[model samples]
Target: MDETENGNLSSDYIAWTIVANVLAKQMNMAGPSAAYNGQAPLSEAQMKRIHDYFFGRLHGGFQIAELAATLGMSRTSFFKRFGRTARVTPNQYLQILRVEKAKILLRNENLTLIEIAFACGYADQSHLARFFKRYVRMSPGRYRSKMREEDVA
Candidate 1:
């Protein structure tokens, strides 16, 4: 709740914000009808193209600026559009993608952590470890050991 400095309740700001966001989402789902009333949202095909372009180059150190250029949008615009369509920003999507790929690579004992890091588009083992801790809640070595245990079972 939002209120004056004196502390009496003035507005349910959080509830209204949630309602506004939900209504905006519903309007976005309404598509062309909503577009005719306001600005046209990206079409399904446009969104697919964006996803395809991003995934196709995901392994080659793709940048938000590069993706924005491919979509003919500014960085902020592309970030908003991609977030609305994918429910995650480009960097989040890329990190998740890389982490998923790293999981698969982890099964290969022949690869070192540094090698896996490079393969997964991370700068180094430390970079991979940081994201693993953030996303997977464990270090890469721990994740690999857990996978190993699961496999043996």
Candidate 2:
């Protein structure tokens, strides 16, 4: 009922929506033959480890080569395996992850653009603005304003 409560509920909804959509996409890709391929599919543990490593690098700053080493894989082999499992190149996946984090931060409206940029692993607000425009089709300020307007309505 209060503003804070409403904001928390909206944030929860947004997070759940993102997770649901991702799960739906994965579910749609599941197939009998896809599981029975000659090469063993990644175990759930392996998938979780890979996902955690990738997500951590995006959410928390970590060098790509270091992450690869932590996974006990060479950079080339790690990238190849990650791409095969995630269906996107490592760089592309990182970009998407960063953009998604930026979207969540945009909704907060308390943090300055520069703060959000660095929090999302961008070099600066300008860097974030460029990628935000490329991926979201609008500047971060505009995106936040629009979302607030929609919330008001």
Q: Candidate 1 residues 27-145, lDDT tens each? A: 78877663333234667987787767656765676777877787677777667666766777777877887888888999998999999998888889999999878889998999899
Error of 2 at 32 (Å): 20
What lDDT does the true structure give each of the candidates?
A: 0.78, 0.78
Q: Write the per-residue lDDT of candidate 2 for residues 1-153, one digit (tens) a residue.
A: 234743787778789999999998897788545434323344577668766776778755556688677766566666666666777876777787898899999999789999999998999999999989998999999999999999999
Using alpha carbons, what is the TM-score of model 2?
0.60
TM-score of model 1 vs. true structure: 0.62
User: Per-residue error at 66 for model 1, in Å?
Assistant: 4.7
- Please give the distance, in angstroms, between residue 60's alpha carbon in candidate 2 and its true position after superposition: 7.2
Best by TM-score: 1
Candidate 1: give the clashing pairs.
none
TM-scores for all candidates?
Answer: 0.62, 0.60
